[model samples]
Target: MSERHPRILVIAEAAHPEWVSVPLVGWSLAQALRDVADVHLVTQIRNRDAILRAGLVEGRDFTAIDSEALARPMWKLAETLRMGQGKGWTIVQAVSALSYPYFERLVWQRFGPEIARGDYDIVHRITPLSPTAASFLAGKCARAGVPFVLGPLNGGVPWPQGFDDIRRAEREYLAPLRAAYKLLPGRGATLHNAAAILAGSRHTGSELPASARHKVFWLPENGIDPARFNRVAAPGDGPLRACFVGRLVPYKGPDMLLEAAAPLLRDGRMVLDIVGDGPMMPGLRAQADGPGSGVTFHGWQPHEAVQDILSRAHLFAFPSIREFGGGAVLEAMALGVVPLIVDYAGPGELVDDSVGIKVPLGTREAITTRFAAELARLAKDPGALAPMAQAARDRVTQHYHWTRKAEKIARVYDWVLKGRPEPKPDL
Candidate 1:
């Protein structure tokens, strides 16, 4: 509400410019916020070099906290217990919850006095995007009479029914006990003391206590950098070019997507480009090895290269069953590649009839059948997809770009600073 830009201390422990998923989300969002506010990012020391390389001056634009004293060991322990990489994400988050407090304590020790003296207009924790990771800083900020904003917190989408096998395959054994995070120390204070909450999904919103619902704003955590994903899709005149970019793991449903596109692949009416590596790679390769399969395995691309390959495709068919925040799907849309995703979780919420298509959630066989049918129809008349493809691009440009996300967040900052006025319509 002030004439000057608001001062924001953005905390993102996992933020790294070169990483993907939550780390990338944290980095992108924190960087984007600089356009809207005077942002000083506080992140884990591990990301210090990358942040510096990205041109932010240490001790001025950002502060790197060395919490690896506890964080590193806990992470290794989590890796051992998780069985392998790309599995047991819940286990990783569970362990992260244990070590994250140390990072916050160091943050408080370094900045408490400045906060108490009102050096920053807002203290926003952008990462530990998981709702399970509670913040003690919230209560501390409250005591100091400074507003602390939490989230766009996202995660904890229940494993859909009939996907128990896929759940087990992903090593998500701790999923059932995910609710126990509600009892974690500081969980209540984190909810009660926060000035505003940005729930990344309806599921994450429901997880918050009813008393805190008044401050909840629905905002998905995933966003795309238009500069990187600026290329437009160049759909060809041959077979319909479709891509699937994510881990080849079961929950992401690479196998299901392969089976679904089998008929089109076998008939030379479609081509599949799979980008990413995971534990399920060998099996997925075998599934697509037959003659006339029209499948190319381009595993684990650099973040920049993904758009180059994706922009050449006509569709992004993602069958992920339990995605918390479908960043990959958003990337596809940003490239003007119309997405065909399972109507569940994050991607389902992102796509609607005007921009992209959604297939109903069901057993593997049912999903495959529906996807096959949709692909067949699209292949029959590829020209019909042009409208939807353009719409997808327009939507991402207007609302899902990193700059747009930052502007929306600025609105939240204004609402909180203006004494939580009635009918905060922008949110």
Candidate 2:
């Protein structure tokens, strides 16, 4: 079995294709891994129906562990705190940290015998993407001599200075407290016991304990399904068509985008397509309607409609200040749309001069100034768009596609099994 496709038990606390963000990541990643490994996905009972709808036999392809009795109270509290937006997401994770172990314990209770019998080559915990959460099965895998893998775990990027106002608006007061997570029970042991660890960003990698740093490899959490983000034959030759796709919020910087792009919008030099709705929408609409404004507010477009908009556009100007998983950015890139994002956090790490444009992190006024200048430069010279757009497509095809990511992680599994310390997977 070791010589063939390595058998894997993939543990995902949140996984369902119908779900977005981390849950969608869990679904996409687990399915992609099956292309290279013999995988039996294990997820929370909440995802059971969706998984079945996607056509997998229960007990054979996947197993749903039921622990709602232990997790319901915390979940309910988090939902109440959520108040219908992203503010509650952090609270959900905080509550989930306490409940995750019970679910993992149930996984071990049911699958422990098979692991001990060497029925599977490895056990990997793929979600609860936060490093703050503790893993329950690392020690059990060690005792059974089955290698354990943790992460692409992400989070804990310090809020960039000068964004205090935005930080407050974002309800991220708990971000600084994340350093305290290192002291969480079993975190150190979880890091120490894992055969290989994949960090989703540079900060996440840097946050790992010194002892475990050597085995840690860098891999971002975002991966594009080519089927969903298909490439276009030829981009439109119309007005420098640009779009911003994300929630309308201060941290996402849609307001900043509007401020910068206003000059180009005047006199019909460019047309801005705003594809999402948020608290900032009313304010953004007012701003976009002002002098020299050629912006269209296509408030809250559906998933497929977003792709259609990108397919016809030349540039995707998303100037988000603190995006962790720039899935939208990657989706735009996969469709040959040139991305313009800030140079900090995930988008900063993902896009370079080679792929798309990067505006350095700074005060809002300064970023708006530089961001507008870059857009103006590109608008003035349309020739630069094609090459950068092509480069963006190539970068995602080479590095960020789902199946490519799956193959790279399969190599990590091989690397862990060989017990080497010098070379990490070049993800």
Top TM-score: which candidate number? Answer: 1
RMSD of model 2, in Å? 2.0
Can you write out model 2's per-residue Cα lDDT over 1-427, one digit (the tens) per residue? 4568899999998899887789998999999999999999999999999999999999999999999998887788877765656774566677788888999999999999999999999999999899989887999999999999998898777778889887777676677676788889999889988988989888788888889987898889989988877756255565678888989988889889888988788867788888988788778888888545788788887777788877777888988888887888899888888899889898888889988889889888989999899888878766568988888889999989889899889888878777543455455
Model 1, 1-427: lDDT tens digits are 7588899999999899899889999999999999999999999999999999999999999999998889889999999999987889999999999889999999999999999999999999999999999898999999999999999899999999999888888889999889999988889989999999999987889889989988888889999997778899997788799999998788888888888888888888899999999888988889998545799999999988999889889999998888998898899888889999999989998999999999999988898899889999989877788899999999999989999989888888988999544334235
Stretches of model 1 off by over 4 angstroms after superposition: 290-292, 420-426
Best candidate (score: lDDT): 1
Off by over 4 Å in 2: 82-84, 290-292, 420-425
lDDT of each: 0.90, 0.85
What does the lDDT read for residue 11 in candidate 1? 94
lDDT of 1: 0.90
